[model samples]
Target: MRNVILYVNLTLDGHLAGPAGELDWMLFDPEMNIALSGEMRSRVDTILTGRAFHHGIEENFRAQASDPASPAELVDFATWMISTPQVVFSRSLAEVAAPHRLAGEDLAAEVAALKALPGKDMVLFGGVSIVQQFVRAGLVDEYWIKLYPTAIGAGQPLFTEQRTRLELVDSKAWASGILTLRYRPAR
Candidate 1:
């Protein structure tokens, strides 16, 4: 079975995004970008996302991959992003283009099926609702949170009201003040 990893960036106060789903405060560290690409290359082969975030992610990466001015590491990472398979979970989207597919409406069932398939682990990039569904269903096997230094007073909280118990398995603190924390759901 494959692992379903929730890889997200959050503020010090735990907000994954602002009230309007703004991620303007996220740290854009080059070193972190390279590390993320490396990790993704080794650990995951699929990108699981919700409809709200799919287009933006695709557009950004596509541009980065084609831009000659982008750094080598970023260009490589962007290339990886566009080449990897993506599964978009949505009830409204009739279809998605190449390298992207529309997932079934039953999120848990779809995930279970995917997990049972022969492949590398899958990473979930959140758009709030989809992340909350996975969290509420207790479907996520691991959490990779890149905690930013800033604290946003008001925004969409990552944990919401759930009292989830997680065991810290690994962590790394960067000089840039960003902390990468890895956790597993306490069994």
Candidate 2:
């Protein structure tokens, strides 16, 4: 079965986003771009995300890929981002557009079915609630968290209400003060 990886960015205080869901704090430098294009993008064949995040990402990447003045690395990343199959978990959304599927109420089943498929791997680009559900269900195989230097006093945290023991597999620190920590749930 393909591994289900969670790739997310968080602040020093463990918040995924600000109180208002703002992501202006993240430093998307060349190192990040390289990792996105060379590591994460190359390994994943599918992307799982929440509905709102899906819409934003789809729109943003589609636009970036089409722009002539965009950086080559970003353009490449955008191409993969728009082309890869995306599963958006949402109960309120009845129908969705192409290259994207709406995963109804049964999130765990849907994730299981995806894992059973013969593919490279899958990455979960979350919007809090979905990540919490997957984490609670123990569906995530690995976590690639980009920890920024600054802290958000109050916001949406990465882990909530659940106690999980993770073993650090690898780590790397970039010049931009972003620390990439890779972990797996302790067996």
Candidate 3:
């Protein structure tokens, strides 16, 4: 079965977004982009996200993939992002365009079905509630968290709905102080 990887960026205080769900404070690094792209290329075949994050992710990457002015590394990453299949967990959306689809109402069941399919691991690029739901359901197999040095005092947190014990598997720190930590549920 494929693993469900929760890949996200968090502030120093562990929030995923600012108080208003804004992401302007998150630091962006070109080197991190290359590393992330390489990881995705090798391990991820599907993209999963909640409705709130789907539009921005799609729009940003689509534009980057097509824009001639985008950096080579970003363009490559954007191309991979757009080409990967995305499953959005949403109830109100009637339908999504090509390369994107709405997951069934049964979140756990839908994820189970996806995992049973033959493919590389799946990445959950979340917006708060979706991450909460998956964590509460105990469905995530791995966590890839990029912790930025910045701190937004109050914001949408990544683990507000669940308490999990994780074992760190690997970690890397960049010169910019962006730290990437990989963890798995403690056995």
Residues 90-122 of candidate 2: C-alpha lDDT, one tens digit per residue = 878888787788886787788888888898899
Quote the positional error of residue 65 for candidate 1 in Å. 0.6
lDDT against the true structure, per candidate, is: 0.89, 0.87, 0.89
Show the lowest summed lDDT stretch of 10 residues, model 2: 28-37
Name the better of 1 and 2 by lDDT. 1
User: What's the residue-level lDDT of 168 in candidate 2?
Assistant: 100
> Candidate 2, which segments miss by more than 4 Å at Cα?
none
lDDT for predicted candidate 1 compared with the true structure: 0.89
Highest TM-score among the candidates is held by which one?
1
Superposed Cα RMSD, model 1: 1.1
Model 3 lDDT, residue 79, Cα: 86
lDDT of 2 at 128: 85
- RMSD for all candidates, in order, please: 1.1, 1.2, 1.2
10-113: candidate 3 lDDT, tens digit per residue:
99998989888888877778788688769767999999999878887888988999999998888988888878889999988999998789999999899999
